[model samples]
Target: MSALLDIRQLHAFYGKSHVLHGVDLHVGAGEIVSLLGRNGVGRSTLVKAAMGQVAARGAVRFKGADILGLKAYQIAHRGLGYVPESRDVFPTLTVEQNLLLGRKRNADTGRWRLGDMYRMFPRLEERRGVAAGLLSGGEQQMLTLCRTLMGDPDLMMIDEPTEGLAPQVVAPVARYLLALRERGIAVLLVEQKLAIALDISQRVYVMGRGAIVFEGTPEQLRQDGGVRREWLEV
Candidate 1:
């Protein structure tokens, strides 16, 4: 598979404090790659840097072109979508309205459509007229994911997608991500849950002290208890 998003020697800083240190990773077309680490290890920072959400330096190439210095919106317009950990949906806007905001102008048509999002999560369709702020946590998370998809991105970086979701709801989210992969969309998922990451990702990168310590397939990671104990296990 060809690389959809690539990062090499990535470094990011929050004000005076440095967070990410030479993090290198890649997501291939039609693949799901999970970034797993303990809190504060800069997993989220790496994705933020890729999206230009924070001050970052070094190579961030999307679809074989450098996008390191582009603004967040500029990156989005380049077919790189981001769903932040906070699930930044428009609170005042209705469900459909918030999704409409994600539609890119003059973008080359992609597989996802508004009707597809509604069909994927019928609950969203039910509350199409309801304000986003009034939706439940799981519903908001769904909205955020579907909203990003509306932009027809070739690659999506999502942070903590199941952070606050109920157990039953988590399965559907995982399935939906797999569906994205089936549709040839690459996913960079930053998640805290070991089971979900292990279950869904084609490959995994373990971060320790802001750098990747291990990169391998799920089976390889599962067989290495030392890496898990040092970087991932709480």
Candidate 2:
């Protein structure tokens, strides 16, 4: 798998408070790489910076082009999708309407369609007529994930996708992510659930104090308890 999104010596800040240190990470084409850590370790910040939602940077290259200084929408149009920790859904819109908003106008429908999203998470199809705000937390999450996919992004950076879901809800979300991988979409997942991340990802990166502390295959990470205790464990 070749590199799809690459960051080298990346640093990010929020106003006066510096957050991410010089971090280095990459996600390969059609691969799933989970970014794991405890809360406030700058896991979200890293993805935000890469998506051009934050300030400061070193190198953020996606598909061999320098995407630094571009706006979020600009980066998104280039095939890098970002779903923030906040499930940003239009409350007033119907589930299908929200998904329609994500469709790129005048562009070739790449990989995702309304049917694809609905097929992946059948609950979305059932609730297509409902307003987004009326849905539960898990349902909103499903809507958000599918909405982003409707844009047909090649690489999606998802932040804390399973944050507040029940176990039953989480299982399908995990399975949907696997389904995305099968469809040749690379995922940069910011995940709090270590088990799901390890189970689905080919590789995992452990973040500590705004920097990458460990990067290895899931099996390698499973064998290394010290890295987990220092960077990931509660």
Clashes of each: 0, 0
Q: Which stretches of candidate 2 lie over 4 Å from their true place?
A: 105-108
TM-score of each: 0.97, 0.97
User: By TM-score, who's the top model here?
Assistant: 2
- Error (Å) of candidate 2 at residue 216 is 0.4
C-alpha lDDT values of all predictions: 0.91, 0.92
Name the lDDT of candidate 1. Answer: 0.91
Per-residue error for 53 in candidate 1, Å, reads 1.2
Q: How does model 2 fare in lDDT?
A: 0.92
Top lDDT: which candidate number?
2
Q: Candidate 1 has which clashing residue pairs, if any?
A: none
The clash number for model 2 is: 0
Tens-place lDDT per residue, model 1, 64-146, is 99999889999999899899999888999999999988888543555777789988898999999999999999999999999
